[model samples]
Target: MTAALRATGVALEAASLIALRQVALRSRAEPVLAALPGGFATRRKGHGHEVADVREYVSGDDIRHLDKGTTARTGALHVRQFHEERDRVTLLVADFRSSMLWGISRAFRSVAAAEALALIGWQGVSEGGRVGLLALTPDGQVAVSPRGRVRGVLDVIGGLVRAHEQALQSVMAGTVADRSLDMAMSGLERLAPLGSEVIIASGFDDMGQGMEQRLAELARRRVPRLIRITDAAAGKLPKGRYPIRLSDGRRLRVSLSGHAQTQHETETICGRAALLIDAGSGVEQTARLLAANLPADRAP
Candidate 1:
């Protein structure tokens, strides 16, 4: 069995998350929080106190906002326009599939994913936004609705820990598979609110067909950030033939001496990711990379 499958202990705890928050607060001007679109202001109009403009009433305009004095003086129907400052929703999608259970670094890919999730979650909540979770595991999937303030952040961290434990159990039993990622993506579409910012933390080893289309559809309405987590071993394989065993008790032999495996893994995982975080990298490095890559306009 892989070391990751047999690993014990919680990869992340509430204390770790709290520490991260303290660090983030100290470096508030570093743009780390701005990496996530969750902190950015949205353009969706709503009934707010701040008047944006005053214009002639249109057929579809809300009648309740009609300006009676303007209509009477100009003999034309007018409506008051207002702009609302809405909080952005940040959804953390953690992939706990069998593939994520393998790592040759300081921790498992799943563990790295959980750490990244925590950092992003804290950043979103600190920026006055809501945080939610979508954990996809071999045993099953778990969804936590977005909550505001500290409660929401804690809920997401709790969900990550639970999903990791369940995934570990599945790995130990050798019942892990790779069919839940597609389903999780589907769930993301249904559960995500309009204009929400989504962070997908995974290795993308089992990215199924039609994933690009689904992501395209999601990007149309929401900001989708791909935090691709991979181990160093995945990029380079020693020249030799290796025996591989399937989760279903099947055994097969494959040659890793050639570049085929490396190329395939790169195309499958790295090619599609917007941001790549190595499993061996530190959590602070991941946060800095994400912040640096964010658009200048999005920076807080």
Candidate 2:
């Protein structure tokens, strides 16, 4: 049992995630974190009342947007650019089923998922957006509503820690997995607003039925993204005998005869994901991957 515990990565405390706030703040100036997915890469441009920028007028510029004071002072037509005023809300959905408790490196898949969400949540908060969480654990679901600034990320971190600990306890007891990814997805509609940025982290262990259809429907109403956490051995294993630990803390040796390929339905369900991070990746690396896909010009 000691050896098994040592081999597997353990759960993370909420305090450990506090440093991610600094990482998120530092990433704001980094060039690697410049790109975001289509929805977040560009700000929503419109003729709304909220002024985003003021620049010298160009050909075909809207006459109504010409700044009279600026034009008269500079002797050149100046136009004001408007961006739609949107309430930036980021919703993080995490899956902590029994399957996510095991991994080959750095941390368990569940822990890695928590780290991923923390990084993203902090980034959202730093950008003047609200962050929330909906975690599906073996014990049940834990939900936190969207909130702005550090308070919001703190709430989400607390939820992640609570959900992960409960899942670890359930694994030790050999309990059945009750939560489903489908349920979490359905709950997004209720928890996330119409224009919310939804990010889901899961190993896709129990995605259940009709996931593709359900995801497509959710995408229509919200900007939903995904992070598929994985372990090294989950892909392909050499044909040989290997010792492994069961969720119930029992050790067992299993023999493999052929090369096994991991056949997950992640592509079918989460084709819109721009990031694919491994469970072995530490928090900083995970955060970097997420940062690379987030908009650099998020409003303060």
Candidate 3:
């Protein structure tokens, strides 16, 4: 792994993820926005119930949201800035199947998925939006409802750790897979409210037959962003026999023929809007990819 990868601990840790909050905060100052459709109201702040701030009234300011006391006291027009009463909920669905338990560099694909979700969760919290989590493990699922501020972010972080650990245990036990991408999508549709924004982080190794249709149906009510996590060896590896360890702790040799398909199945499912991130990428790169892919309105 290059120095840029800057791999963290092999195991999942919340303290490490909490530390990324500062990085998430800094990323806002110098955002590298991606080209996406405009008018996403996921992070739209306007005249509503809760007051966000009071500022000098500018041209085009809504007079109804004006602060009469502040204007009278200062002898100048001032207005109250209110956050939309309806919470801008961002539901993060991270896949933790056995396939995500492997990685070529940096953290494991599962761990990297957690890191990505943490970064995005922090960003959502910073924007005064609510954040939730849905972790699809090999055995089952872990879901967290949308919550705002620090508590919400913490809930998501905790959920990620729990789900990852469950998946890890299942992998070690060599258990049969019980959860799949299609099931996760179904959980998302059931849990996510209308108008909520959904982001699913997965390796897409198990993009089931029904996934494309499920995602399409989800798009009608909620804005969904698919984040495809990949490893460094996603491309053709050198043709040779290599020793590998299985999830059950068994060792075996596998042969590579140097023929790997460049799959666009994820893009095809999401209508050419899937975000790609390498598992080998470090926190910095993950942050950049997220900022580039997420809706502009979601940024702080």
Q: Candidate 1 local accuracy as lDDT?
A: 0.71
Higher-scoring candidate on TM-score, 1 or 2: 2
What lDDT tens digits, residue by residue, belong to model 2 across residues 74-115? Answer: 999999987554457889998887778777667888888888
For model 1, the superposed segments whose C-alpha errors exceed 4 Å read 1-14, 26-28, 31-86, 236-238, 257-273, 294-300
lDDT of 3 by residue, 161-231 (tens): 88877877776567845555786556677778898888888888767778878888887898777778877
Question: What lDDT score belongs to each candidate, Candidate 1 first?
Answer: 0.71, 0.74, 0.76
TM-score of each: 0.71, 0.73, 0.79
Off by over 4 Å in 2: 1-9, 33-37, 41-86, 184-186, 233-239, 243-271, 297-300
- How many clashes in each structure? 0, 0, 0
Q: Regarding lDDT, does 2 or 3 come out ahead?
A: 3
The Cα RMSD of model 2 versus the native structure comes to: 6.2
Candidate No. with top TM-score: 3
Candidate 1 lDDT over residue span 198-226, tens digit each = 88989877677767877778878887878
Rank candidates by TM-score, best first. Answer: 3, 2, 1
**By summed lDDT, which 10 consecutive residues of candidate 1 come out lowest?**
261-270
RMSD over all Cα atoms, model 1:
9.2
